[model samples]
Target: MATEKSGTVGKALGLLTLLGDYPEGATAGQIADAVGYPFSTAYRLLNTLVETGFAGYDRREKRYRLGLRIYQLGQKVAHHRGFEGAAVPILQRLTDLTGESSILAVLDDDRFLTVHKVDGPQFRTTTDPGDRGPLHTSALGKVLLACTDPATREHLLETIELTPRTEHSITDRAELRRQIDQVRRRGWAGQQEENDIGMAAVAVPVLSASDRLVAAVALAAPIFRADQEALQAHLPDLRRAAATLALELPLRA
Candidate 1:
């Protein structure tokens, strides 16, 4: 039973992911408090992780950090993502056409993971390739939510805390749901100054051959350079790129 997907094994993996957030390492108590786990359970999981080489403990500081094994597995995952061979060229082409940065993102649990990007001139900020973007404010997040299965999207909307990144973020639940529906109807998503001031974005989904939403590709630029209409005008280009990625990129979902 403990080996079940919802059991301690799963929690331990989640704990391992949480440890990555604390680059400086964390105590068992700190980790427990962060995930609301009991002290005894957290200590046991930490020890098990250490024994399995999934985590490292500094005896002097008594803090735990991600171990070498995680790096090994992460390298393998990066290899499987196949970005260099597949996604990069597509994103680059989209940027070349639109004169804006192109981002490729996937839905990972409750977060939107930025897996690849092609940055245009004067386009570099918080949205790096490895960053985890907020669901309520990002064009990538909105498109993923709109295109995902109804059950998952509903669960995300209910469980995820819509903490506003900026004053323009959609903190109101009803309004956010309405906007998500609009994104669904329009077959693409767009935002202006929702996540960050002076930034605007639009995204289209990369649906699989079976019509499942696999990933999202977005074009982002400064509002001064391209307003909402200008970004939407490039939807033809973005959707073409997304269609190409849908065929090229491997989909686990």
Candidate 2:
């Protein structure tokens, strides 16, 4: 059912996501029924989205489809597939530089969404491109939380359960905050056997030219293959890759 939480903005974007399902496009009435909204409400919101260029109306077919603006913005985020072509090689190079798996993640709701991943020649991880990971346990998640604005960070910390994936995971919110604080200060984050036993990771935020947090990249490997010191040693390479990706992501300011 359509929700009231985000009011019009949320519903409108929800419509866009729903629209993605119909590549041939959908009529306003079809969209309204799918979302459980009144025809008039759906039509108005769809028109609004069309006017803003986030959606398009097919006059001949009397249908709505995703617009060019959506494609332009989608080309900057990995999961959108438009930017994956550019992101894949960068991740591959990072994996080569560190001799570990490289991960590219973006915020998905309150979790870290794995959008792109490159496995090292020596080892492979169970996590894949569409995996969603805990925000409190993985290095990618920490960098995302640490770099976000204070309000969002606090909201996530307060609301997200500190679910321990392994014995090393920080289940305590206070301790997690301290770790996040350290990550904020150091401009990077690390996790040891937190998300997975015998696995470790280190990450840095991919910031836009304007210094806005666009995404995060991480190098992950098993502890036997790369211990904490080994992981931290790759920080320089990770930062360099992130810096380079910042220019490539092309996020909206």
Candidate 3:
């Protein structure tokens, strides 16, 4: 029994290494081949990972992928302070200035999680806090993706499988990478009728004092009301708000 347990641990470690090497993830057979392990052993380990929340499976493709648990563990270590407590007031100010709803979001696990949000008046439009959207489909998600380190970004893209939420959603990996580069160059990202038809959004990344990206701030409104001039006009305030949040975010040691 002891020998069997030791062998299992070794196999699990080998599986993790394979995943780390290939961020785009691997099939059961591919993982087995990568680790040079027996097919049955690799299959068992993959099944155990899915059962324990250490990996995810794509129902459509029938492939194994890394789960949110790895990201959750990283978040625990990366962000020790509560994000909402420090960022809510800043988001409120953005709403007060722009009259559009503001979202304070962090890249949670494998998805963007809204930690705080400030709603605008009845005339304004909004989405809910705690709403989860595809990274390739939302402005806030794009900014977060664009601002992070390149190696990590590539790793994330590998782990991510883009699902077309709408016709405007970026389904092509190369196109998404090109747009992300544009966001990095311009210091902001925008989505027009991408995730939701008739809705539009602009987002900028909040960087901590240590220069690590902490979250993204976004202003969302009806697409008809958010023309190019209006979006460009709001950019300064948006950038300022992100910078303000960055200043307030605790420097994780």
What local distance difference test score does each model get? Answer: 0.85, 0.85, 0.77
> Number of clashing residue pairs in every model?
0, 0, 1
Q: What are the per-residue Cα lDDT tens digits for candidate 1 across 70-91?
A: 6445645774675364689988
Question: What ranges in model 2 sit over 4 Å off?
Answer: 1-40, 43-84
| Winner by lDDT between candidate 3 and candidate 1 | 1
TM-score of 3: 0.65
lDDT of 2 by residue, 119-145 (tens): 888888867666778999899999999
All candidates' TM-scores? 0.70, 0.72, 0.65
Summed over model 2, clashes come to 0
Question: Residue 3, candidate 2: how far off, in angstroms?
Answer: 22
Residue pairs whose backbone atoms clash in candidate 2? none
The local distance difference test score of model 1 is: 0.85
Candidate 3 residue-wise lDDT, 1-253, digit = tens: 9999998988897787677676666788998888888899899999898887678776556678776566456445444454445677888888889988888777754578665777766444445455566788888899888878777688877778788878988888889989988999998899888878787888988888666888899888776677434676798999899889888864321
